[model samples]
Target: MRISAVPDAADVDLEKIDLFDPLLYSDGDPHPIWTAMRQRAPLHRQVLPDGRQFWSVTRHGDACRVLSAHREFSSERGSLLHQLGKGDAASGKMLVSADPPRHSELRGPLNRMFSAKAVASAEPRIRRAVLATLPPPGHSGPWDVATSAALLPMAVAASFMAFPEEDWVDLVQWTSMAAAPEDPSFRVSSPAATLAIAHHQLFDYFAKHMRHRRANPGEDVVSYLTTMRAGSEQLTDEEVVYNCYSLLLGANATTPHTVAGTILAMAEHAPHFLRHGDADGTRVPLLIEEGLRWTSPASSFLRHAVQDVTLSGGTVREGDAVVVWVGSANRDEEVFSEPFRFDLTRDAGRHIAFGFGPHYCLGSALARIALRIYFSEFLRRFAGAELAGDPVHLRSNFIAGLVHLPMSLVPRAGT
Candidate 1:
């Protein structure tokens, strides 16, 4: 876990170390590593047990620079440290890993589905889905907001993407594990088994749908994908599968975490809810942004450098891996005022919770719409939602969300 020392050793005399054990960040104590790096050594280089060395970008501005600067540091090498195995990695291109011209080609079609007008049109269906899943009024005792939120978004997102609703939960389980295998809770099986299952499930599912869309086109995103040609080179069956799989994971994992985080934040900041009164749904969207700023779902993305580049006053050599800490950046004091406090009214749109640059999340607009509808309906149905039991956090750093949120749903007056 030894880290290469920073230059001009006299000024910054800091003991260099790996952020933590392989699984530490996933366990929920990123602040100790992030706080130390931000103050003492914002750009620390560390070597891992596997002989892999990476530059840890912990500060706010540095993260943005790495994410936005596509030329120097490339996402082409893939976004995570765990290399894809023979079963999946050998098959096709994952959009998050591609560079420039190729990246644009891969994302072009998918981005159309998230266009403002398209997402806005999906609002009624999304709201109806939310209302359908929510516990009916007068239901007593605690309930898992995470499970509740997680279930609805996956179903709605899958429906929008043309996947059968029956397979929704399993898709979520697979993606959650694939995103953070190091975390014990998310490790359903060995890396190989997880990859194999994901590869088989997603590819087979989309391959069939692609044919169906070609024969009988629908208004959904997958239908649009069928017509796209990536510069006379259309995405192979695997590419379409992986892209759709990524969308499902994105909508399911991140949005639900924000939902649970918003509820927890509201409980803590009861005065805000009191001040807003019955305008909870309107205020919930603001709360969603604030929660995303507070608990960024995709905590970090790993990128490999194509050439030597100096960043954060540190020199990064070619082929070096840089771990950009997204959550740390969202909370950096330089950019945020009282960064830790969950201020419901704070301007959180600028936060890189959904990431930045060309690789920014294409499903972001859709995610916001889902959140607005989720919270809007949630507040409308259950006016005085109170925590009925202790909430548990997910044991994964890559995608943070609640595991179990026990709550009592108090019905709103006249509902």
Candidate 2:
């Protein structure tokens, strides 16, 4: 269902008092707004600039309800605030846009590949990649935390997809463009045009590798996609291409930003890290979970209501869109004591940073492994680190990402 018309000033005026504005996220800290929403209007409705109205589920319980009740809130319609044209190639083909039993069908073949065991097996290689990308011991100066954190995930994803070493930079660029289409550095003409270009480039890149893998299957993910069958049917070319794009985009986007956010959190909240002493492997998992909760890089995901549903705060009509604000939910005071404080001891495992239910992030395990290894290695190399400059956040509301994070790593005194 489309919005009837641009909301009148009266309606817009009501929303203006709250943090429902997407632009608010791009400006600076949205925690105050989110906190107000959680207290005042957990399930708030706001009209977009284009007049489309969506319900924002900010409370933790409400966010979980919206995300987990797939039957009531369908993903097939579209998972973004802006609806895709019916003819758009990725409309329902990407994993995030599919509902069960199609969602289950599509997810089954790839489950083993990203299972706990699989991610664990990849740890050593991920460690090496992290180590290789980190500055050497005596190296010290301004470093881009976002760039540094991005390397291992990109390298691991490229290796998993069997992408050529030389093309890793291209893969990173395309994924960044796709995820941050609103950023001036990545935007080309318009967000739609930028996304379309990025999608096309990724599809073409994967198609070439897929064709090769089809003829000569290897152990990599691309090979698995090319050869795997579901029941009597093979995955359509569209499915293969779009899902490959999904994996590549998913692998590169969230973790890097979270890592950068974690480092910044460490610098800003020095006592949190210092109290635990050096970042040992024992506490890395806790730190990673906290980082994921603190960063929540993949902020909000839109789901269309399949039927009328009543949430804790209000009712949503059928066909209306509801945005599950995972970032806000992660900071819900009701669930997290002293929510804003970045405490490593907090049981943050329940955070929905990876989302929830059917569309929960497929690469979450891999992401956690990458984060754990990267931070462990980071701590070993650098006794301390500090932000050298302000972090520049991505413009898009969907992705809570840092385009640049200038930091200076304090190399171990002896090293």
Candidate 3:
């Protein structure tokens, strides 16, 4: 609840800071804490309230090293901060949680689908989806940018998977619950209960869809996945269903927050918005990258040390959980000059916002295209926009996102 300015690095008590606490991120300003960690304790260790302890990798290089060394740092156990016990449904089935060989097998078939060229091919569809989600021209004032930004990504996901348009809302709801189970709006009986229910719902939905895709194949992601093979192995029904769930969650969850954050950034920093408006097509890509870096929506993912590893003068024993803070890494002063400033022209492509290494986000390409189209259309339609009220950040350490952003849009005069 306190909004005090971040103290000097020396003043910070590394032991006292709880990076896993959801409230640390509730204000949408975890940068200062991360900055202190990166500078003073790049390999800080802390224990969660539940008595689980993990090493937090805050620096860019260290984070990259941990993420890249999949052999030494495994994701097979789980990728979330909260450890899902052996009984947990999504422990190793999802693509993000699989280790190499298996990781390669899961991701190999979908590589081309998310390639730069493939995402470029989806631009027109993404643009149409963006346009469809935008409010009618001449309608403006105190709109919830978060809700508006949230809609198109789900629509795009449905289009990509050949899922029903009517089910987009359901997809959004389930993914939201799964992603931010601690948030009051999305939480059901409890975080675990909410996640279990959401997982069940998503699995059921995908299972039914997978059955249909097998019976009558189409050119969607589901159809391709159903037929995809890995050497002598083929995807199981559970694999297909769980991976579909993974894709849906990955594709739907992060971009909307980035889009909403972009709008907020532009409104707060008018010069940036003006520059974006005046720039050519090449500049748009930079803007999109900047948005991803600035927002860092998919904040942190956990990796388990498969073997003893020395990082930043700290030893992480085998089986120790290592939390790689992508959001922190993106703003590390070592890699990014003036990291706090939102400089669209900066080489933000180097940012690990989509993460690094084997478990890197599969839908990164699609997310970029969706964000580009959304911003392009948004700027063209609205001459200027401003925040109408305080933004509400999602209460989850895993996702740095705005769940609500009230904004007033000023349409282009002629429109």
**Each prediction's whole-model lDDT (CA):** 0.70, 0.77, 0.80
Q: Which structure is stronger by TM-score: 1 or 2?
A: 2
Badly placed stretches (over 4 Å) of model 2 are 1-14, 17-22, 84-88, 271-280
Residue lDDT tens for model 1, 1-415 = 0011121223433454445344454343556567667877788877766666777888888898889888887876667655411122522276786777787887777677788788888887877777766777666467778777777777678779767777777777776666555455556477557656765766677778888987898988777776777757877766776676667767776777777877776665554463334563567767778877876877778877788988885889988888888877887778888776777778888899989888898888877877777666666666566778877666554665567778776666666
Error of 3 at 322 (Å): 0.3
The digit string of per-residue lDDT tens for model 2 on 236-287 reads 7878888898898888878788888888887777534643445436777888
Q: Count of backbone clashes for each model?
A: 1, 0, 0
Q: What would the per-residue lDDT of candidate 3 be over residues 117-226, giving only the tens digit for each residue?
A: 98788787877887787766776787898987787788888888998888888889999999999988799998989988998899899999999999999989999888
Q: Which prediction has the highest lDDT against the true structure?
A: 3
In what order do the candidates fall by TM-score, top score first?
Answer: 3, 2, 1
Worst 10 residues of 3 by lDDT: 1-10
Instruction: Give stretches of model 3 more than 4 Å off.
Output: 1-10, 84-92
Q: How accurate is candidate 3 locally (lDDT)?
A: 0.80
